[model samples]
Target: MTDQTDEEYREAPSDRTHVKRYHWLARYDQETVKAILDATPLAHVGCMMNGVPFVTPTFFWREGDRVYWHGSSAGRMFHALEHQDICFTVSMLDGLVIARSAYNFNCNFRSVMLLGRAELIKDEDEKAEKLRNFVNGLIPGEWERLRPVYPKEIKATAIASMSIAEASCKVRTGPPIDDDEDYTHPSWAGVIPIRYQVLPPEPDPRNLPDVSMPEDVLKFRLG
Candidate 1:
């Protein structure tokens, strides 16, 4: 993900005032937002169909709370949300955001779960715009280089929008936790920062011999 200015992101605290069970709605920090979005690839989108609740984890690209996804026009998940209410969630775990106390120990993460109704964005122009957002989010400049979506491609897929209404953000960070008695034990106790990166890209064998990886995608330092 591109480095973002602090002012570019915003997360609001949940309405719950008590920190019981999981204080999911208690924290609204920028670090929390970045950690979650940067750490994971899949997002579980919730929707209701025929009075039954359903959730499907699919490939997603997030821009703030607004998420865009496309799939076969006939798929169950896509069909279910074609004209219904839906919710989307994106989460990423960056190592263990743990601490030295039971209450303090927490996972380092940034996750945003949103609720809102969805509607198929039938406007051809709008659909094209959303598609660009998804491609850019995955690997910048891909949409321009890859073949443009054909009119048939658009007709064969379903694209929709979900308003980011009520959302909850939670996060945890720091070192490992130990009981009062265990705290005195001499043991290593700090986080080992985890990282992910993309190796050199491999070209498809069927391609006419010599296409190198794109600079935009190759420049990524996956963590």
Candidate 2:
């Protein structure tokens, strides 16, 4: 239930997860939600600290029904998030919808909003393994090529995870929808498509000149 592994659409676990405005664009299915989450490595986690709300941007990864993010252990955000209710959200814009009217102008996008409580991965070993997975998940085989992570390094970082059981996916696509009479107007109406690209690798100056890009590095692609 957490991972949205089932093919059938499910109901929102709570009213908060349901999409209200533009309700037709809201999706309550596991597959759709999971896809949106996997499409982006970045997300914002909204949490409360000392009664003040804070939204922290983080690089996140998903495994099964859970997602994880990290920050410096000494940072107030991580410590403030422990065992707290959180709103985790990811969004990627695919295109710009140019409409005949300003009101109809919008973005073609896919996004997921997740509701859950945050938990810390307290076990050092598990945390370290998950950290390794994060590096390799973004760049395959990159973790192995780097120096081993120090025990102190692990201690200095905080890993937070949240379940994805209660989540909603919202998406908008295709051309803009304008007033019925706007179709006869001279203004153009269409989508300006956008996409992500993997550029040529830029090696660091400190790297040995003889060192070449690893095969796995070349194999990396944005999901």
Candidate 3:
């Protein structure tokens, strides 16, 4: 992300992340990559285990310039990820574009891909604090009122972290571009906008008579 022009950044930190087609839509700046990852609520984690490839979907969380995700300590994904090369990606599809020609059809989206190895947080106290931050980050005030985490539960979970140092983002927006001759073809051409919204929560039927939705849940926003 340094020693390069905006255009060069698009091509990138390495050939692996370089944008080949539609290179103009790519961005290598730290801000753009971070924002794209933050906007997407989930990150697809990829790694290899026992000579087989695996991609696990997990909640995405960013702290400072790092990315984190958690799973069972004994899980295959976590076991394969520890200090091992891996890739994680996040994407948000914004709309669909209809072009006069079938070949010109495309989807509008923002996406990021990162490469690195995860460092397991071995310190119990630090891991506990990180979990607390992760919970409150997704839902403010929820962690404060929750029951204390048991020692066994902490022992059973694994939290992995890696700096968002090597990554690239590609984003496409606006309407489709069709050949000049195709403009008069009388075919419908426009965008079908997509929206991501948080709907009203449905409380569990088993809640106690006096139980009610918490204020934190009311104001929660995924980012």
Model 3 alpha-carbon drift over 4 Å, by segment: 1-6, 9-11
Worst 10 residues of 3 by lDDT: 1-10
Best by the TM-score measure? 3
TM-score of every model versus the real structure: 0.72, 0.92, 0.93
lDDT of each: 0.63, 0.85, 0.85
Candidate 1's error at 201, in angstroms?
1.2
- Can you write out model 3's per-residue Cα lDDT over 1-223, one digit (the tens) per residue? 1233656755577778787767777788899988987786699999999998889999868998999888889888887787578989999989999999999999999999998888988788888888998899888888887888999888888999988888888888889889989999999999999879998888999988997789889887767
Residue 190's C-alpha lDDT in candidate 2?
96
Worst 10 residues of 2 by lDDT: 1-10
Pairs that collide, model 2? none
Mind giving the per-residue lDDT tens digits that candidate 1 earns over 1-223? Answer: 1243333333344343223345433444545544555566677888877788888887755556555677777878877775765668787665764445546455555566665666677777787888887777678888998887898887777786664445556555556656767777565466766555567877678876666678887776542
The 10-residue segment with the lowest total lDDT in model 1: 1-10
Per-residue error for 138 in candidate 3, Å, reads: 1.1
- Which residue segments of model 1 deviate by more than 4 Å? 1-20, 29-35, 38-41, 50-52, 63-65, 82-85, 97-106, 185-192, 221-223
Instruction: Count the clashes in each prediction.
Output: 7, 0, 0
Write down the RMSD of all candidates, one decimal each.
6.0, 4.1, 2.9
